[model samples]
Structures are given as structure tokens and as C-alpha cells.
Target: MTAAPAFPPLVEAYLADLEHALAASEPRERAETLAAVREHAAESLALHGSDDAGARRVLDELGPVDAIAAASTPAAPAAAGAPAAPAATPAADVWLVVLAVASLALFVVPLVAAAAVIWAVVRLRAGVGNRRVQTLALAVGTVSLVGAAALYVSHVLAG
Candidate 1:
């Protein structure tokens, strides 16, 4: 078997930093991670034929000390008995827009449009409608109702 390769001071310093960063990890875990990193460095050195510059290249590929340490740490496990989260419900904006459009029937039939607008408001307050689109619907509905009322009053005055 061939003797192990000796890395330059820079590579040693990088490894030292990596070890320091991983100190909080379990001993066996830390050793395993460090060993892998060393193995990679050794292989890179062999390919480069003992060139010290290869150490920097190998360590660079291994990534920064902090990143390696962070990667080695796992997230906390969830409680065994907890229920999984439910899927999200679809937004109600489409129906709200439909109602808003229906409300514009105020020009043709004020009573129908009024009912549609009332229903839209109820949905908005109930949190069923999407806020952004519902606001635009409210504007359209209000304009249609107002225009209808104005036309009705004008017709009566002209007649």
C-alpha cells in the first residue's frame, strides 16, 4: 500500500476550520464527515501529483467550512403522533368576479344586480372571496348601480 499524501498548510487550516465548525455534532458523525472530506482531498491530491495548489481546489469543491457544518446538521424531527397539515383550499376570487359581473345587471334589472352585490358583500365579509379581486368587483358593481339609478331618474325627469 502507498503512503498517505501530506496536504499544504492552507488545506490543513481549512480542515481545522471545518472540524471546529462541526464540533457541536456527535463525535462519530463529525469523524465520518471529516473522513469523507479528507478522502476527497487525498484523491484530488493524487490526481494533481502532490501539487499544493490542488489542496485549495479540492477544499473549494468541498465548500466552505460553515456550509459543510450546516449541511451535516439535520432538522428536528416532528412529534410521532401529530397529524399532517391539510391541503390549502382554492381561492374564491373567481366566484366573486362572477357575482360582480352579475351585479352589473343593475343596468338591465336593478333588483337582480342589487341581490348579486349583496351576496358578494356577504361572501367578502365571510372571507370566502379574494380581497384583491373582490375590491375591484365592488368598484364595478357600485359604478353600474349608480349609473343605472342616474339613467332611471333622467328618464323620469325627461318624460
Candidate 2:
């Protein structure tokens, strides 16, 4: 009625530009393809409340016709022989693995082994390194250190 845009020249021009740009698409698909674009422009107009400047801004954001057409086209495939490289293990993890193995000497070197176990527990809780390997290291160190402590406690009680 009186509130409507009977002469929405900018909107008409934008749609015409979009149609020309979409010439590469199949004739049957052109209408369906532009459905989303039309909906967006309508929504923009509604939000801006019949303002022509808002309509112009939305059309500007859609950019030139050629660019829109190019964007809709599929990208070219990657060239052959481009395999990705494997990730390297962290230095801290390597040290943790070594210490976990050494922690088996709990009886001969309780303090160092106990320290190693504590380090492993901290690392394990913090989710450091590869899970399976860190878990194995933690298990080995924890059991040996606990055994060492149990033996020391029993020896003191027996005396």
C-alpha cells in the first residue's frame, strides 16, 4: 500500500546484477539459487525499516556479480604427493618415561624413586604426554614406591 516500496530501483538493480552473475549456473537452478539471496535482502529491508540506504549497504556487502558467481563455484583439487608429517614427542614426556623406568629401583634408591613417582603422579594428573605410556609409567612407579614404603614401615614396627 502507501508504506510499500513500489519503486525499489536499487533492489531491482541488485537482483538483476545477481542474475547476470549467476549465468554460469543451470537455467533451472537460477530461481532456486537466488531464493536465499532474496530472503536476506527482504530481511535486511525489514530490519532497516524501509530505509533505502540499508538496502544499498546489504547489496554492497554481497559485492560485485562476478565475485558472487566465483564464490558459488567449486574449488580446484589439491595436487598429488602431499602427505602430512607426524608430530614429534615432547622432551618432558621422554624424561618422564626414563624416570618411570628408573623408579623401579625403589629399594636401592628410595628417595630418587619416590621423587620420580611423585613427579609421575603430578604429570599423570596434569594429563601430560601420550596417555597409555604415561599411565604405564605411573602404574610401575606407584606400585614400586608403595612397596618400598610398606617394607620400611614393617621393618620399623618389627624392631
Candidate 3:
């Protein structure tokens, strides 16, 4: 096996700080910020002479960890404007009901539907609204239900 490339101490510290900052950020912004940090580190390593002092200097120039985290995070809307109204609780309940109906349809359908509904509800409760999660749940539930129906029909035909 090839030997792993070693990072200088300062470079390692910078990377650790970057990781912490990325972890504290929202999921939506994480990818882009991570890419930027990775690119910057690569560029810095390439330009700097291979010396600990050089790495330290580069990291120091990059500034503090908190500043980096703040810069990477998306700014929340200013409170000057009227606050947006909360989403209707009943809508989420409706989604849960639909999920329940889909789950009752067949074998694996209920399991998949229940998982999706549970995941969406948990995310919503945690103040995360992901349209992708909702869409995935709906699609998976429908497909499973349809598959279950088709299997039942085939069995009847065979009988």
C-alpha cells in the first residue's frame, strides 16, 4: 500500500477547524462550504514552501475559526420585516394520515410508508423542512403499494 501523505501541523489544525465549522452549519450549505475549504487548502499547500512555519503563517492569515463558520453559514432573514407565519399543523397531520392509508395497503408498503412518515415528522419537529424527504416518502409509498397490488393480482390469476 502507498504511504499516506502527511499534513503539516498547522494545515491539520486548519482542517480540523474547517470540519467543526462545517458540522455546525446547516446541511444545505455544508457541501459548498466544504468544497471551498478543500480547494483553498489544496491551493495553499501547493503555493507554500514545504515548511511548518509557512503552514503556520498561511493558517494565521486565514483568521479565526468562528469567523470562518459565520462566513460559511447562510444569514437568517432580518427581523425588521413581519415574521412569516408558521406552517399549518394540520397539513403535517394530513400527510401522516395519507402515509397511514398507504401503509395499510400491503406487505412492504406499510413499512416503507411508516418509515417515511416518521422521518418527515422527526425532521419537521427539529425545525427542518425538506421537500426532498416528503417527495421521496410519497414516491416510495405509492410504488410499494402498487407493487403489492400487482403481486396480489398475479397470485389471483395464477389460482
Candidate 4:
């Protein structure tokens, strides 16, 4: 039998999409899906007996890459089953106000308070679920820190 021609590009693209979908999926689920995809691709290629046609068929069976990625991801947890939490409040606004007040008093206490604000901002940015609030807090905290530093420098220069 004549050897089938190589379809490197098509195969590579298919593999890339598969990998992307895997990455977006949960760790345990990703492993299973990856194994299934590998096996399916191999089987299709063997059955088709031509690399180009095999790759095309495999990709068609897999469906859209984005759809696969979305499917593999876990759904966001619903609030119904959990305890009744308080309604969502603008916590970031409150935090910004607190930080601003703290910043003014920080001048007498030196950088300690300013450092605390910076630390809180970093923690918020890292762990907070609300991206908008995290970003606002970070911006306000950063500005406060910079202002505090400038005040300290000016104080020393004047004295």
C-alpha cells in the first residue's frame, strides 16, 4: 500500500485547539477529556487511512474549539443551596473611605499605617472575587501610598 501523505499543519491545529480546551477544563476532567480525544483521534486516523481526511473528520466530530472549552469548564456555583448571605454591598467604597481616613492619620504614625493599607490592597487584589472592586481598592491604596511617601519627603526637606 502507498504511504499516506503527511498533513502536519491540520494535525497541529487540531492538537492546539484540543490543548486549549483541556487547559480551560477542571484538572481531573481535563485529564479524562484529553485521553478520550487522543484515543478518538488515533482511531479516526487509522480508519480513514489518509492524514488530511482524518484530521478534518476528527475536527468536525470534536465541534467548535470554543464550545468544547466552555463545555469542559465547571459551572459557577449557584447561591440557592448555600446559606442566605447578606445582599451584595459596595465593600470597595467603604474600604476606600477607611483607607483615605487612615492615610491622613498615617503621617503621625509614619509608614506603618501606609504599609498596612498597601498590604490590604494587595490581598484584596489577589483574593477578592469582584474584579471591579479589587481594581478600585488597589488604585486608591496605591495613590494613598504615593501621597504618603511624598509628604514624608517634604517634611524632611523642610526640617
Candidate with top TM-score is 1
Local error of candidate 3 at residue 15 (angstroms):
1.3
In model 2, which runs have C-alpha deviations exceeding 4 angstroms?
1-87
Give the whole-model CA lDDT for all candidates, comma-separated: 0.74, 0.70, 0.64, 0.64
Error of 4 at 38 (Å): 0.9
> How much is 118 displaced in model 2, in angstroms?
2.3
**TM-score winner between candidates 1 and 3:** 1
Candidate number with greatest lDDT: 1
Which tens-of-lDDT digit does each residue in 50-115 have in candidate 4? Answer: 467777887788677677667786633466678766646466546655665575556455464455
Model 2 clash count equals 0
Q: In candidate 2, what are the lDDT values of residues 13-89, reduced to their tens digit?
A: 87888888877675556666677677777777777754678778777766776776766653233546777465576
Model 1 agreement with the true structure over 1-159: per-residue lDDT tens digits: 967557777788888999899887767889999988888888887786555677767777888898889877643335677776754433566665676687676476676556556766776788764666767767777777777788899999999
Query: Against the true structure, what is every candidate's RMSD?
Result: 13.4, 11.9, 12.6, 11.2
TM-score of 3: 0.39
Assess the local accuracy of residue 152 in candidate 3 as a C-alpha lDDT between 0 and 100. Answer: 72
Task: Sort by lDDT, best first.
Answer: 1, 2, 4, 3
Between candidates 1 and 2, the one scoring higher on TM-score is 1
* Candidate 3: C-alpha lDDT: 0.64
